[model samples]
Target: MIILTGVGDVKTAIESLKHGAHDFILKPVNVEELLIAAERALERRELLIERREYQVTLERRVEEATRDLDAAYTKLQDTYRATLEALGSALDTRDVGTQSHSRRVHGYSLSIARTHGVPGHQLEDLEQGVLLHDIGKIGIPDAILLKPGPLTPEEWKIMRTHPEIGKRLIERIPFLRGAVPVVWCHHERWDGTGYPRGLRREAIPLAARIFAVADAFDAMTFDRPYSRAISFAAARTEIHRCAATHFDPAVVATFLSIPESLFEDIRRRSLEP
Candidate 1:
């Protein structure tokens, strides 16, 4: 059956033809014939159907491509995370005392950062920085790194090169460029007395400042070659005493405010056999 469209008083002409007109055409149309017009309209309908089918096929292909791209992206992210974890693990293996140290520091740094209202994007960089803070230690000799006794002034001077080494290492990796400052400056003191570079106060990167407190707290609370683990309260007191001198005061305040249970949990997780 023909369907009439755009008709404007043209139905009268079709009606006058008296050939049981099934549809009408509007102005600017020739009213002299009807069969040829019907054929053309039918052909247009068929063409429209073919065009719609092509569009449906194109849309399906597009959706499939999008899904494939998403899957690839997810895989890439997973691979990158695995690589980072593996690199951290390798560094830990080189220094048995450092096993799980990076992870604990990362957790602590992230907690302090969150408490201090660091933006979400920067928090991610902080976490990574904390994990790799000691990466430069890889460059230190085993005699210096695992020495049972305190370092001599000369040896200490040599040991201080790790941060710069770590910064160099990370600079070579494009994905970790944002974390270079944290690696290089985590050892810097708030009072401008620390090694490598004497960056003081706000001049030090925030991530490094946050990491310093966390790293020191973890080191004091955990068993080390030179000393036994201290109680959490003792550690907290020591951390407070050093605020503004050894660490950023604001970071120390936040660190002190963290519940003891949180430190316990961190210690527990690190102690897992």
Candidate 2:
């Protein structure tokens, strides 16, 4: 940073500065002036070192703060999921003979969605949607939700309202709004015969379309008061039969592509006795 130059060489001094020389002196330098210049340069260097250290300390603090913020957000996300799961599980409490339905359907929905290329946090959103999908059934009387057989026409009308109710309820929570489609439209049919919005084809969100297949598969394979459980192959057959009618054809195809072992393993875990 220190340089020797002619006292009259202003141009050379400027050039040296342009080239990153911090200080310079004349060739016929006074010893005192030269010592002063050297002392000033050393002081400047120390100041620069201090400044760099301060910047490093500031950067480290910022990084620590960012990491803490990320961790807090992660914990908040976990709490959100746990709360939704609890609410979803409460649905099973209202109905008898079917415990862990929400968890089962969540697992099934996740599997189907992943097979359809829904990756990362979108998959988590779908999981949230699955857990909270049945939340609006809280408004329905147990008489309708737990009916051992088919619901009456009047009961069916009320039953269909659950999707809209769920949509309204969940959109109130900003973070959960991303999952509204699965909660509200999972029952939609590919042919537009579904209730509520009756969205057809690509109009339905892929998450909901994927959920429809998962929900149906779980429904058919699991025991209900009106019917006994069916084999995985039988459920798969039913899903294929309804493709493009009750379910998305692409989603159905994806569901079929999944190995039976994956489903069997999920089913084997945490089934209610």
Candidate 3:
């Protein structure tokens, strides 16, 4: 339907533009011209509305896709972290006597790394390495690992294979490859006397070196079947004594400088049985 209105020449044209009217005729009107203009105006309005709707729909879809991508990314991160924790737990469970050993080693290693000013990324690697350091023990025969007495020469040979076993196990998992060196070499000594390659001094990976100190400290201070747990003071002395032999001298020095109270607290927390 075509509608036309005019108060005067100028006002009539202004009103048509402002109100988006179909058409306006002068005092002498032409019905045919008005009808044509009305049809064209309505068609243009429909096209504009459709274009706006299309744009809005496109934006909505883009937002939804972005949300989906974000959700997937979050799930991936959660899965990776859970998998790491589970692997650590699995290794721990394999050794019934060492129930919370992995967790304690992780905490102690990070603490030592922090005290020694290890770099951020390196510290993270150290933590992961320490948590899974003994994972290779899983491959060893239960008789050797759970023996009531000291291992015989042949049993010791079999037991010493764990580092390689652990390294191989972790290397197969892509995310854990960075931690394999530490897992493989944590048993190595600073003076070139330890096993699984006998990598010594600076030749050993720094993460492994750091973990070695933390692992030994925990081992010495914790009660085992063959020995009683030592005092923090004794543990400190032993760490210092082994500085240049079993442990990196600099790392041991740094560890000694850490307050005794800290080690005591860690020991207490770890004993939450």
Candidate 4:
């Protein structure tokens, strides 16, 4: 502020100064001093304008960078899922009679997890885990993996090692690291009788727990060479009966609560070409 007054005392000048007066000019103000004060104020105003513009530009740049990061993250996720799908498809072909089973199981597990209130970020890992749950079969001999009859005790021993094999296969991959638990522990029982590692109850990762129910449901409901397909109702009854023994009771409840129509829808979509 520039104060121009015809009469003023030291006290008034001090008060004006305190009130933010840039210049206090008495009557007969010098033209040169007035011009200098006006120039200084204009210069200060320009500096403030420039500062504001700079801040606005900086904010805009930050917003643009944030958007770019989000897009890149989305693309990376897509790539990861595509890779998992390709790997799953390859495994399915080798297993025989299980075509599209992984896809169906993926849908079921994701639904069960969402209904169970699993965090959004972990859902992707869960999906990947479900799709690749049998990845370790790659390490097994074709003779054992493709056997038409029930596996012998020796073959079963070799078969169970597939989970360990799967862990070794994926644990080193940075993106698949979160999914290792499901691959390694999907066969574990809620009663701690599960193989490889005896993780039981809450000691098991929630993703693996949710996956166990989904996998068993798919296996029971879908036809495989060794087993005839059962009705969804029958499968649900068996699943419910096994709660707290083969499946986590809480996860079983969540699975049972999911609308049957949704499960049918996921199954229908999974069969599409």
lDDT winner: 4
Models ranked on TM-score? 2, 4, 1, 3
Tens digits of per-residue lDDT for model 4, 181-265: 8999999999999978988899999999999999999999999999999999999999999999999999999999998889999
- List lDDT for all candidates, in order: 0.82, 0.86, 0.81, 0.91
Could you give the candidate ranking by lDDT, starting with the highest?
Answer: 4, 2, 1, 3
lDDT of 3 by residue, 1-273 (tens): 344554657866876677766556554567777667778878988998999999999999999999999999999978876676667777877774666777677777788889888889887677677777888888898888889788899999999999999998889988778788789998899999999998889999988888888888877877777777897788889989999999999989888888878776776776685
Question: What is the per-residue lDDT of model 2 for residues 117-160, given as tens digits with 9 covering 90 to 100?
Answer: 88887898888888888878878887888888889999999999
Model 2 segments beyond 4 Å from truth? 119-121
- Model 4 TM-score relative to the real fold: 0.90
Worst 10 residues of 2 by lDDT: 264-273
Tens digit per residue, CA lDDT, model 1, 1-273 = 444445556556666446644456654556554566788767877888999999999999999999999999999978876777667767877875667777677677788889888999898688677767778988899999888788999999889999999999899988898788789998899999997889999999998898899889889888877778898899889999999899999989888888989877876776576
Q: Candidate 3 — number of clashing residue pairs? A: 0
Overall local distance difference test of candidate 2:
0.86
* Higher-ranked by TM-score: 3 or 4: 4
Q: If both were scored by TM-score, which would come out higher, candidate 1 or candidate 2?
A: 2
Model 2 clashing residue pairs (backbone): none
- Residue 183 of model 3 has an lDDT of 90
Q: What is the TM-score of each candidate against the true structure?
A: 0.80, 0.92, 0.71, 0.90
Alpha carbon lDDT at 251, candidate 4:
95
Off by over 4 Å in 4: 5-28
